[model samples]
Structures are given as structure tokens and as C-alpha cells.
Target chain A: MKVLSRLLQIREASILLFIFLFVGCIGIVNPAFTSGDSLGLILKSSMILLVLAVGQSFVLLTANIDVSVGSTMGLSAAVCGILLSHGVSGYLAVGAALVIGLCIGAANGLGVSFFRIPSIIMTLGTLGIVRGYMLFYTEGRWIEDIPHYFKELSAAAFLGIQLPVWIGGIAAVLAFIFLSRFSVGRYFYAVGDNEAGARLIGLPVRFITVLAFTFSGLSASIAACLFVMNIGFVPNQTGSGIELQVIAAAVLGGVSLSGGQGSLFGAALGAIFLEVINHSLVFLKVPAYWNNAISGFLLLLIVTGDSRFQLWLKGNGKKKKQEQEDMNRSKLPKSGEDGYEDKVVL
Target chain B: MKIKWFYRWEFFLLLLFIVEIAIFGWISPGFLHVNNLLFSMNDFMFISIAAIPMTLVIISGGIDVSIGSIMGLCSIILGVSWSHGVNVWLAVIIAIFCGLAAGLFNGLIILYSRVQPLVVTLGSMFLFSGLALVISGGSKASGYEGISGFPDAFVQLGNGSFLGVPNPVWFLFVMTAAFCTLLHFMKYGRSVYLVGINSKAALYSGLRIKWISLSTYILSGLGGGLSGILLTSYFSSARADLGSEAVLPVITAVVLGGTSIIGGRGSIAGTVLASIVIGFMQYGLQAIGLTSEQASIVIGAMLILSVMARQSSFQKVMQWFRQRKSNSSDLMY
Candidate 1:
């Protein structure tokens, strides 16, 4: 009973268990679903999404979102590709990408924090503006013929895993540690939990808000780099409309849309879960077009369930408190007049 | 009456409008011609028309980003229905109803499920776009070829002039007047304002907040449907991509008109005038040898600058300057 109750407390654990069950079901349908090569490919494809989800988790934890992450990723990739093609070293190109990402993220943060623009509106504007710049730079052309060294990084495996998987692993571990062990991480939770209170306590409210977006930008740039390496080319549509999937992943991983409680590990698991589900559909020979509809429906279900569960938990907590109060009152042995007065008070 | 005039943002917008027209007339003699102005106005009529109810939705503390897709969906429905020997009027009604259904679905999901409007609408944007693609098989519906046989009266609704003004422009005027009055004068309008300002307080005051929000989305759908119809007739072609470019312009017009994105404050008249401003800006820039893309950069910059200026701190600085000037004049006296 204690274990069952504990399981209910950790909502993300149940979601992870559900993902494993889904994998098992898919494996029964097609053994290829569980093969080493397929698993590796899934991990590689999910790496960029995983990174973006980590960033999204942070912003969403603070009751905000960064819809511009996908656009930032595209912009960064295009800048990196253009610079690399101009004979810039891969390292320099990567650095340039990070800078571009940081600038864009800072702009968004400033709009939201200083100018008092809502994060969604600010990010929505940047999403278009950045994408427009990318279109202008690329002239609607895909970037192919990347240097062999960059492509090799994506292709090479360390200890039977792709480079992207390793990168994802490191990101997940680092995010988990920062969120769990550091004062800054706790500050993020505190801000998300209650901004007014956090401010009253003299937290660097505006700076922390900006830092969340800066982290988001850095993660998006890193994700873009990984994407360029893995995909071997950058298309105009690269990362277009990917914000939805990343947000969906974070939400599905038990990140409350209302803000405050979530885990980076849960976000990573969410990305993996989505990838596995997509793979399962392909393995089951479902039409590719149906995937969008199915995934959208699943997201709606999960989000609705999370909200209902939160309400239920709150209701149960209230009810338990009431029961405890009732027991405490009943414990008093009373004379008739005293009992009558107690009943009137109740 | 005095209070009303002071509170209206439209007066300021109208001043801007007159100033722009005068400047453009001076810069380019052709801009003074009625035909040239009307032609330029016609280009953005779709966005102007859609912005009316979009203003209401945003003012009510929600957004309907799916209107672009809703317009596309309606156009396709109109095209398909017309090709099937359906009566044109009936086809239009059906098209409008289709848009309403889409909006209703968005409203239901957002209100009943308590999902964030941004996320729900974002998902529906893709859903509606995908549905349009599937229904049209990723091809243009070819309104020019398919709708050639539409009656003269129907076509005249888009092209024919009334009192020397284009019919669509006149239609825009009528709708703008109706919406502006409805939003500013009616009891329902007051409720919508209250709901947008503080939904919890509105609920406590006995307003059916959900229904109010739901109705705003429905109004947005109706507006999108009207735009879809006009676009179908004007372009003489209905395609799945018809109005895809209108989303940014619509949002830009609203924000530029000083509508708060966090909701509760907006004006229909301001939006209408802002749309005209944008229309003129697009035309003026194009006249000066800027491509559509470059024009977009100018519009984006203007939006950012306008938002920054609207921030309260900026207002305080201006007030301070005015106060300093007044104090110095007193010293001189």
C-alpha cells in the first residue's frame, strides 16, 4: 500500500512506466523495434528535441514559454553553415551559432522582462523575424556539402552509441544535477512557485528570468549543431514548427503548464517516449499522415489528464484535512450542553 | 459625448491616417488619385476584414491564431461546394458555418478542458491547415477556373463599386462600424471588457465567462469567413494557401493599434485605422523600390518600436520632459 501510494506521488514515474509498456507492445508487433540499430537511430533523432525540451522545461517551469527556440535553432544552423562554407573552422562556426542564439534569446527576455511584453507574444514575433532572416540568408536553399569532419562527428559512435546520443546523455545528466543540487536551480523553482514571494525575498527576479531564456538559446544552438551534423544538411524547413513537439514533450513528461513542478529527466524521457511512439507507428505500417493527428490527440489527452489529476489531488488534500479536523473534534468527551455548542460551531 | 471623445483611441489614429495620406500625396502625385488609393486598399482588404473580430478575441483575453487557416478552410469549402452545382449563396453560408465549427471546436477545447488558449489554438492552426491540405489534395482549388460561372451579383459583391467606392471597401466600412459600436456601446461589450480585465471578478459578478470567450472566437470565425469569401472573389482563385500571409499582418495591425497582448484593452476603430496605416505603408514602401520581404522588416521594426514606446516608463519620460518645459516657462515669466 505504501509503495502504491508512493508511486502515485511521482507522476512522471508512471509516465515512464507507460512508455516502457508501449515499447514492449511495439516489440511484440515487430522485433525490429527493440533492435540495437533502431534504438540508436531513435536516440540520435531525439537528441535535438531532448535538448530543446530541457530548455523548454526551464522556461515553462517559470510559467513562460519560448516559441522562438525552433526559429533560433534554424537561424543558428544557417549561420553556422554559412560561416563553415566560408572556410571558417567548425569550432568558430559553433561559437558564432551560440552567440547568435544568445542575442536572440536575450532580446526575447528583455522584451518580456523590461518592456513587459508577454513571453508568448514576444517569442511569436521573434519566431517570424528570425525565420525571415534565415530565408533571406539561404534564399530558400538547403545547405548541403558540409565539411566531412562535422558529419563524421555525427556518424561516429563511442562505446556503441552515436555522438548525438552521448551528447544528449551528457545534457540530461548535467541538467538533472543543476536542477537538483544547485541554489540557482532551487531559485528557478521558487520563482515559478510564486513570483511575488520570490521577489519579496530579494531574488534576482529579472536576472533569473533572463538567465532562463539565455539557457534556452544556448540549448537551441547546441541542438541545431547536432541536427546539422546528423542530418548532413540544413533545409529551409529545418526546425520549422518544432516548438510544438518540444513543448508537447515537456508537458507530457509531467511539466505542469501552470508552472512549478517538473524534472529534466522527465523531459528527456518524454522526448524518448514520443520518438518511440512515432517509430511504433511506422513499424505497424500506419500511414505517415495519421501520425500528426494521433500525436495531437495524445497530447490533448495527457494535458487534460494532468490538469484533472492536479485538481483531484487538491480536492483529496482538502478532504483529508477536513477528516482530521473532524476526528480531533470527536475525540473530546463532552456534556450535552457542550456537545450542543460544538455542533453549533461546526 | 465629451467623455466618449476623450476616451476614444480612434481620434488619434484618424489624425495619423490624415497625416499619412497628406505625406504620401505630396511624395507621389499618383497617391492622391482615388483609383490608386482604392487599388492599394484592396490589396489588404482581407487582413483589414479579419482584424475586426480578431480585435474582439484579443480584447477578450484570448487569441485565435487559427484564423489564417480558418480562412483557407472556408475558401476551399466554398470552392468545392460551388463546383458541385451548389447554389452560391448556400455555398457561402456553408463556408461560414464551416469556419464557425472550427472556431467552436477551438473554443470548446480551450474553455472546457482548461487548456491554454495559445497551445490549443496553435494545435488547431496545424489541424485546420492539414485538413485543408487533405481536402484539397495539396492542390489549388482554382477558383478562377472553377468559379467563373458565379453570378454577376456575387462577383459584384467583391469588384463592383457603390457610390464610386469598391464594394469590398464599403463592406469593410459597414462591418467596422457595426463591430465598433457593438464593442464600445453594448452591455455584452461591457461584459467582455470586464471578463478580459479580470475573469475571476467577472465570474463572481455573474457573467458567463466561458460563453463570452466562446462567442469572441465565434465572432473571429465569422470575420475570417467573410474575408475568405472576399478573397475568393477578388483573386478569382481559391487555394489552400489563400490568406496564409494575413496572420502576421493581422496581429501586427492589432498590436500597432495599441491593443494589449495580455488582454482586456483594445479598440475596433484603432485596429481599422491601423490596418489602413499598414496598407499605406506597404504600398508606400513598395513604391520606393522595396520588395515584400524588405517591407516586412520595416513593419517588424515599427511594431517593436511602437510596443517599446507604449511601455509605461517611456510615457513617464515624455511626461517628465513636458513638466520640465512648463516649469522653465514659469521661471521665464
Candidate 2:
């Protein structure tokens, strides 16, 4: 009974329902969309998105965002792919991608944690700097000719499931334990829920903040390696603007953008749902232009849903009170009432 | 830093702009021609126009990442409408209205839901851009080609000069003065600052916080619409992807111009100078032997550099955190 009730929880349940509804609607319109092959296709394509969203959940849990993830993914894929094509061993190529991820993640973490620039602005700036660096180094060309073995590895499956799927599944389970059962995991929620109080209680708030960002970067790099291994080529615009999609996926999965809430499972599921939507567009033969708008519309819808999820979790007695409280206390950063410089954290 | 010098970031930016120009002229003598400067100024009127209202939004402690996507949507509306034989001015009017509606939509959702501005606008950015692509007629022009064949008079809005100055520069000047008055001199502006500085205090002061917050977003949308109109006329075409690249520079101008990203403090004068500084720096870099790509990279480097200099603002952030902690236990929501 407990397991059944947990499975039926509103946030994840609603997302699950939407995925079915969307797929069913498309499946009815086009009989081919319901085929077993198409189902397999959606699952396989969602693997990369699932990977990236899992990565993003760590940072979001800490009450920060990483707009630079897309750039990090791009840089990782480019460097790894380029190295592979240049006759470097595949192991070294993967290692280089992880190193690139670590460096960018550390830089982003330092800027946000120590320098005190808002994560959004700092990451935005770094996005440009990293992209510009990539552009200058690559000189506006695509990185191609990745070894055939790399793509084959991604394609190979253990016991009928693809390799990437296994990777995502294993990562998801491990992340759930790490976030829910670990002290460091709880530290994220504590800091984001109340930053000053968290500091007063003697938490290494700075270290956790930076570590959260580094994890985000590290995830993007792993996703990058997956992407390069799967695609066999890294285009200049690879992962461009994908940060938005990744964030949307996490938010849809029930990860709160204001931070200190949600789960990696929800994030990974959200990524799956998004990829399913992206594939649905293709299956429905919808114009490519509508893709962005539809996903964006769904983002809004899901945000509304997430807030309702929050409300539902708050209990029935406080629903009205909480609703009223939300209206009164929404504008949080301005609490100083005097200092003109005070800003919103989340 | 004192409030007086904290208030002087824009002035410092202006000094930096002048220095950039002089350095460019020294590096390349041909860079100082009057015509080149005016024409260069024309390209950035859209940014300046957009940044004016963006200043107000940031001052109100909100950010509108969707504004660039709004510009794209409005331009497509103008392009598709004009192509289908709607009167040119009517198309523009319709586009601006649509843009205004989009902005209001952004405002409405954020106000009623109590969601953060960042999450709301980030979602809207994708939605608006997708809508632009949908309206652009996938079968006809596709996404990249956009829609052209606007009226000659409409085209002239972008290309024509007024009193020996380009239309965009004129647009920039007029819009700057208008925004300055609306944001700094008016009662509504004070309400905006009050709401941003402390909504609880604003409530006690008998201010309408929701309306002020909503209106700032609407103003931001209007600014985006105006820029869309200018960009369409200037490019003589409209693309779904138009203005996508300019989002960063617009935000850079607002923040680098001295507006606190946290809200409650900024000036139209600061945004204007920052706009000019960005335009000047881009052109100046190009003149002194930099590719457009290289200049863009430099601009990116400069964004990080400028933001890093504002380390003073974070101290107040800690105080704000304490206030939140004290209030959190008592506040049920």
C-alpha cells in the first residue's frame, strides 16, 4: 500500500499521465507512432537528455542554476571528438572531456560561491567566454571523423537494453541514494532553504555550493561524451541553447527552480518526457518551428503543476493560508526594506 | 563603496566608451569617420530601445530573458502580416499589440503564481520563439529565410536618416528621454522602486505592488516590441531567429550599465551609456584588427570582467538573507 501510494504521488503521477496522453494523442493521429519500434526509439533518444537532466538536478537542489552546461557539453564533445579523430586513444579522449568539465565546473562554482556574482549572470558570461573560446580554437569548423568504435559502444546493449539506458538507470539510482541518504545531500536543501541560517549552524556552505556546481558540470561532460560517442561528430552549435531544455526537463520532473526540493528521478523522468515530446513532433510530422513553442508552453503548464504539487504537499489545513501567504511573501529578496542593493537569491 | 560612487558605474562606463573610441582611432585612422560611427550606431538602436525598459524590470527586481524571443515573434508577425497584404502600419500596430500581450502574459503568470521571474521568462522565451516559427509559415519561407517584401515606406523606417542622423539614433535619443521621465520622474517609478526594494514595506506604504510589478513586465514587452519594429525595418526582413543573439548584450548593458541584478536600483542614463559602450566596444574591437567573432569573444570576456567588479553588492545580499531567516519561521508559506 505504501509503495502504491508513493507511485501515485501527484507531481510524478501528473507527468506520467501527460506523457501517456501526449503519446496516445499522437499515436491515434499516426498509427506508426504507437509501434513497438517507435517506443524503443523514444526511449533510446531520451537517454542523452536523461543524462544531462540528472546532472542539472544537483545544482538546482542547491538553489543555483548553470546556464553554462550547454557550453560545457559543447566544449566537452568538441574536445573529445577532436582528440579521437586526431588518433588519440578513446580513453584519453573521454578523460579530456571529464577534465574540461571539471575545470569549467570549478570556475563556475568559484564565481558563484566565492565571487558572489549571481549564478545566472556568471554562467551567462562564462557561456559566452567558453563558446568564444571554442569558436576561436575550432575556427568555425565541425569536429568529425570520430572512430567507428565509439558509436558502436553506445549502440551495444546488455540484455536487450542499449548502453546509455543502463548508464542513465544506474546513475539515477545512485544519485537518489546520494541525495536522500547522505549528509552532503541534506546540506544542499538546508543551505538553499535558509542560506544565512545554514551558515550560522556551521555548515561548509561555500564548499557545498561549489561542489554542487562541479557536479552539474561533471554531468554535462558525461552527457557530452555520450553525445560524441553516439553522433560521431560534434557540430559547432551542438548543445547550443540546450541549457533551457535541460532546466525545463528538471523543472518538469518536479525539481523546484527556487531550489531545495525535488529529486533526480523526477529530473531524469522529465528529460525522458521532453525527449518523448521532441520525438513526438517528428513522429506527428509537425513543423520543426513548433517544437520550441510547444516545449515552452509545456514548461509553463508544468510550472503551474509544480506549484500545485507544492501546495498539495503542504497539507489541507494550510492550503488557504499558504495560498494567501504566497501572494504576500513572493517577493522575497526585498526583505531588507532599506538597502537598495538587496537581490533575490533563487 | 559609497552610494555616490556606486551610482557612478554608468559614468565610468561612459568614460570607458570614450577611451575605447580613442584607442580604436589610434589603432586605425579610418575608424574616426563621422559616417561610419552613425551607421554603426544604427545597428544597436534595437538594443538601446530594448534596454530602456529592461532597466525598469531589473530595478523592479525581475529579469526578462524572453524579450529577445518576443522581438522575434513581433517581427514575424509584422513580416507575415505585411506579406499577406495587410496595411504596413496596421501590421506594425498589430505586431506591437501582440508583443504587448505577450509581455502582459509574462507579467500575469508571474504575478498570480508568485513564481520567480527567471523561471517564468525562461519558459516564455522558448514558447515565443516557437510561436514565431509557427507563424512564419513552415511550408513557405521555413525558419531561416524569414519573411521579406515589406512596404517601401516601412523599409525606410530602418534605412532613412533624419536631420543628418540615422533613424535608429533618433529613435534611441527619443526613447531614452521618454524612459528617463517615465522611470525617474513619475510616481509610478517610485512605486516600482518601492516594490522592488521591499514588497512588505511597499504594502504598508499603501502601494499596489502587484500592478506595479505587472506593469514593469508590460513595459519590458513594449520595449521588445519597439526593438522588433526597428530590427524588421533595419534588416528589411524578419526571421524567427532574429534578436536571439542580442539577449546577452541587452542584459549585459542593463547590468554593466550599473543596474543591480537584484533589483531596486538603476537609471535610464546608465543603460543608455552602457548600450553605447557595447556598440562602441564591438566596432572599436573590429576596427583595431578583430574579427566579428573575435569581437564577440572579447565582449563575452568583458561581461565577466565588468560583473566581477561589482563585488560590493553581495554584502547587502547577506543582510537580505538574515531578514528572510527571521521571517521564515513566522511565515507559513
Q: Pick by DockQ: which candidate is best?
A: 2
> What is candidate 2's fraction of native contacts?
0.49
Per-residue alpha-carbon lDDT of model 2 for B88-118, expressed as tens digits? 9999999899889999999988865556787
Model 2: DockQ against the native? Answer: 0.35
Give the per-residue lDDT of model 2 (tens digit) for A54-78: 8888888877888889988988988
* Lowest-sum lDDT 10-residue window in model 1 chain A: A337-346
Once model 2 is optimally superposed onto the true structure by TM-score, how far is the C-alpha of residue A146 displaced, in angstroms? 1.2
For all candidates, state DockQ relative to the true structure: 0.16, 0.35
Query: What would the per-residue lDDT of candidate 1 be over residues B1-333, giving only the tens digit for each residue?
Result: 244454245565677678878887898887888888886788888888999999988887787777887898898788778777888889889998998898888887777556566656766776676566555653344322233456776777777888888988998889988998899989899888887777766766778877888999888888888898898888765666678667768988887787777678888888888899878887887887665655665666566765665666656765676688789999999
Show model 1 residue runs off by greater than 4 Å: A1-11, A21-34, A139-141, A273-281, A284-286, A316-346, B1-32, B138-161, B244-246, B289-291, B317-333
Error (Å) of candidate 2 at residue A139 is 1.1
RMSD of each: 7.2, 6.9
Clashing pairs in 2: none
Give the C-alpha interface root-mean-square deviation per candidate: 11.5, 4.3
By TM-score, the best candidate is 2
Query: After superposing candidate 2, which stretches have Cα over 4 Å from the reference?
Result: A1-10, A306-316, A319-344, B1-7, B138-140, B288-291, B312-333
